[model samples]
Target: MLIIPAIDIKEGKCVRLTRGDFNQKKIYLDNPRDMAIIWRKQNAKMLHIVDLDAALTGEMTNFEKIREIVTDLDIPVQVGGGIRSVDAVKRYLDIGVSRVVIGSAAVTDPKLVERLMKIYRPSQIVVGIDAENGIPKIKGWTESSGLKDFDLALRMKSMGIERVIYTDISRDGMMQGFGYESTKRFAERAGMKITASGGVTNAEDMKRLIELQPYGVDSVIIGKALYECNFPCQELWYAFEEGITLDHNFSTARKK
Candidate 1:
């Protein structure tokens, strides 16, 4: 499992929104490049970035800044937010974005998925299916898609989408823990590989997620907990640098 760090950018600043609430946002850094560099220096293999401004407005507000962050990192960065069309996806990919995540587009434009997949290959595309009480949320979690996450996932899978990032809006930015059972339900129903996100609190949480690796939860995205130092980040950084994979809880939970 990979420990991917998140950089949520709003108004050109790195910020995080609690429970996907815009009014509840807290700025974490002035420059997103600085945060990307920090995670890169910490030996992160990949970075997850979301443009909060674009997510709500459907504009590439911080495209240049995102380009800078992507340029500075030797690792890949998967970017999301307001990516609606083939041109936007192409523009981002042209500038070195490893994968482009489609949120609202995935729900509103299913044919766009087919077009993008045909051109960029499946690995270069990711769909974010964020849900609240099983219904998929779109347009930065402000609008309901009137479709269950599993239904959306099934559509994406049928359209040849290989990977998806599943985030539970209620748990996002709350540091509660992974929405394992819900994610499992989606994974089982959608039958696609998933990267679980939102509310990952600590190492134990990571262990639990790792254990779900067999259930199509290949990796997870952690934000608040990691930013708040919910676990031994320094040690984990060293381990990442050394290519050391620590068994989740060293078998304590597995013993059960």
Candidate 2:
């Protein structure tokens, strides 16, 4: 299973919103690019980035910052947030983003996904299903799509979407625990590979997710816990690099 680190950009700063609540955000790093380098130094296989400002406003507010991180990191980076149009999707991929995650568009514009699938390989496009109480939420979790999570996942699967990032909004950033059952059910019903997100607090949560790997839950996106050093591994990494400067160009052997 892949342990992906998440860097959510709001107003050009790396921040984490509690329970998807924009009003309750905590800034972790002033420069998101630096945070990306730290994750790379700590051996993150893939990095997950979300432009929170764009997610709510539907504008690529942090595009330049994201592009900078993408340029600096050798690891694959998957980005999501306000990627509503085909042009926006192309823009991200054109800049060498490994994959572009479609969120609101996946719910509001199903045909857009169909059209994108024809142009881009399935591996290059991902659908983000953010849900609250089984109903899929769109536009940065501010509105509900009036469709169940499973329904949305099934719809994307029918459109040839091979993988989805499933986030349970209620548990997001709470650090209470993960929505394991909800994620498992979504994967089982949709019959597609899932990258679970939201409220992954500690090692027990990770262990639970590992148990569901057989059900198509292969990886997870962790934000707050990682930033706050919820895992022991992070503690060690931080201690070892406390005074040492990081070489941003440091590279990991690419996984085959």
TM-score of candidate 2 to 2 decimals = 0.91
lDDT string for model 1 (76-194, tens) is 99999999999999999999999999999998898999999889889999999999989999998999999989988888988889999999888899888878788778888887889
Provide the overall lDDT of each model, using Cα atoms, as 2-decimal numbers: 0.87, 0.88
TM-score of each: 0.92, 0.91
Question: Which candidate's TM-score is highest?
Answer: 1
Q: Stretches of candidate 2 above 4 Å error?
A: 234-256
lDDT of 1: 0.87
| Sliding window of 10 residues with minimal summed lDDT for model 1 | 233-242
lDDT by residue (tens digit), candidate 2, 1-256: 6778999999999999998888999998899999999998786778999999899988999999999999998999999999999999999998989999999999888999999999999999999999988898989898989998988888888989999999999899998999988888888898888999999998888878888978899888989999888864444333323354333343222211
**CA lDDT, candidate 1, residue 240:** 32
What local lDDT score does residue 114 receive in model 2, on the 0 to 100 scale?
A: 98
Residue 252 local lDDT, model 1:
49
